[model samples]
Target: MLNLLVIDGVLLFLVTITALAVIEMRNLFAVTMLTGVYSLLMAAVWTNMHAVDVAFTEAAVGAGISTILILGTLVHVGVKERRREKSLNLSALLIVTLTGGALIYGTLDMPAFGDPEAPVQTHRFQKLFDQNVGKVPVTDTHHVEAVAHGAEQHGGEQHGAHEDEFHGHVYNTVTSLLADYRSFDTMFETAVILSAGLSMIMLLRRRSDEEIEAATQRTERVDPDTIKTERMDPKTTQTVRVDSPPGSDSSGADKKLAAEIAEAVDSAEQIQHDAPEETDKGDQV
Candidate 1:
């Protein structure tokens, strides 16, 4: 009993620490890992309490499937939480404190651990179970050795009798309760878990190849780094010449337009020189 208590205490302490670490953690990846660790610790605690079925469920669903789902969610949502200023919310703190106090108070009325006179053990359902299936036999090492010796002496006859005794009945009470007596509840629980898993798969499923290809096509075809844009300065003027293909002949009209443009430029330069000479002649007169 002391050993069980010690183990339970240790597991609970680990669970508490993990929970705190998860709450304090900003990184979603680390928090997801800590959550799985916390679930595993709780599963250990449940197994120590002899609730093996619950422990198995917790380990598989909480630690295994749940961790996988959270990881998938992180892929889409990113693994880092948005940074925000942390502030203590007094209302939330008050609510949590009150809820914890209420839970502790509720447990005060409950029976001690493994108490035979507890409501669960003394309940009508338990009486029915005992009457129908018989209480599970507790066998020690000496009892097991004696049974083995008897089985050897009697051979097939003893083996047949033992089989007949446990026929059509589950030896484990918890298994019997979940599998036989409360089968509908168990079935519904399984359905709920299945639905949840399917929903998660739907939500976290990757895009189809066609959708991915379409998205790729929508992106810019040209690389921004490879593109060069030349911006001309407003203060500078540049003349661009359009060169025809080497074998292409220039039209007569194009040649005539080019000659007229060159003649106009030359005339403008001659008038500038004649103005300077006329000004010098007027000064001499």
Candidate 2:
């Protein structure tokens, strides 16, 4: 009991100090690493308290991957926090008060810490370890019952029509579920570990020549003209004449249009000249 208290006190002390450091430290990289150490210490505490799975996740994700990725980002961009310390006003105090009140109201319904008679521990945790793997709750025990109803479900019966018994141990029913009943889940967990490894490799990875080529192929080719150039009227001619003198335009097409207009005017004038003058001479006769 004294040792347990000592352990708890030490953990609490570390947690408090780490929290303060996290809040006070201006260096984001240092804060991230500190957060990882905090998580590692928390995992240690959880393991000491006999919650193994939670500890494992904290070790892998919180301490290892999260820390690495965050620190990597800090290295790339910067190590400084974006904002300075906030000055607390009345609004801040009021909001804090409301939040504290709500938290207190929520806490009123919570069971006291370490109450052994709490429904969670006495029923859920103890029952899981005590129950038989054959008697898995809410499952079709048909196949399991048919083969090894009494004996442990391992070392017997081929699954999926293959020549081997279900590849699993029946020590814990959940493990039995993961390994045998849900072998895909075991594969999924292995896949998660594989993904983490792949992520680590990718985060630190260099692209191969083929990969680079493939990426280049995947990228869309952009037209320089189509990009953000100064918007100008495309119909307007780009070539500026060296001299502004008459008939000195560089484009013969412009001079040609003027000649066409002049020829049309001449044709109209000749048509008017050839027309006979109309008179009332027939009526006089």
Candidate 3:
């Protein structure tokens, strides 16, 4: 009993320290990891108290699912938390104190740890154990042997009869209680776990606004003729040229040809006018 108490106290102390560290942590990534550690410590505490079902649930959801969800969120939102300088609020402290006091007061009514005569043991479980005990064989032969040995060490007779009596019986009372007596509760817990998993999937399996916009932009239809090809010079800014389709004339070359044709036409007209004047002058002479 002293050893159990000592281990429980040490585990409780570690749990408290981890919780405080999580609270004081400013980096969200560290906080998330610490939260997982806290849940695992809590699961250990529950296992030590013989609440294996609760421990399993805590380890799976709190340490596994919840940690993954938080890490996913961290990947999206980044690891740093924004901090603002401000004076402490007395009201908040007062509220926290009152809540803590209420919780402590509530624990006062609970039975002492491992109290064999607790109401739950004497009233709630006695009948359940009577109904289902010894239905399944204790799987571990070592445990059976140990029990028989302990009985013999205590100078108790009929060790063989005790072994025979407990033959084919499950050694774990918790399993029987959960599987037989509180099956409905376990079933509901499973349902809750499924629901929570679905909720996390819905929350995490999402496309962000930026991602949606980028996809939309990628799939947007652009006219082939409207596409602009751009080239940049180190000294110049934002120069663009239109792309010509295959077999199409280059715009710059086309403009140059037009200018040459107009200039040739104008020069030929000038020569024709000058020739007429020259011919008139020769006839007059």
Best-fitting candidate, scored by TM-score: 1
lDDT of 1 at 141: 29
Tens digit per residue, CA lDDT, model 3, 1-285: 789878989999999999989977889999999999999999999998888888998999899989998998899899997777344568878999999999999989999867888888786465355543332244544454556556457554323323224332556766766776578998998899799889977877555465455445543422222223211221111222333442233344434433554465567678878887553355442
Clashing pairs in 1: none
lDDT of 1 by residue, 1-285 (tens): 899899889889998999989987889999999999999999999999888888999999899988998998899799998867456668888999999999999999899967999988775654346525333244432354446666457642333332223443666777767776677999998999899879967976655565456446643322111111112321211221233321132344334434554465467568767787544355442
- Encode model 2's per-residue lDDT on 1-285: one tens digit a residue: 679878977997897899879877888988998999898988888877766777888888889988988887887889987665474367868998999999999988887867778777675454344432233333444555444444335443222223323333355565655566568878988999899889978877655565455446533422222212212322221222222322222344444433554565567567766874532246552
TM-scores for every candidate against the unseen true structure: 0.57, 0.50, 0.55
| Residue 235 displacement in candidate 3 (angstroms) | 50
Candidate ranking (TM-score, best to worst): 1, 3, 2
lDDT of each: 0.67, 0.62, 0.67
Lowest lDDT block of 10, candidate 2: 222-231
TM-score, predicted candidate 2 vs. hidden true structure: 0.50
Give the higher-TM-score candidate: 2 or 3: 3
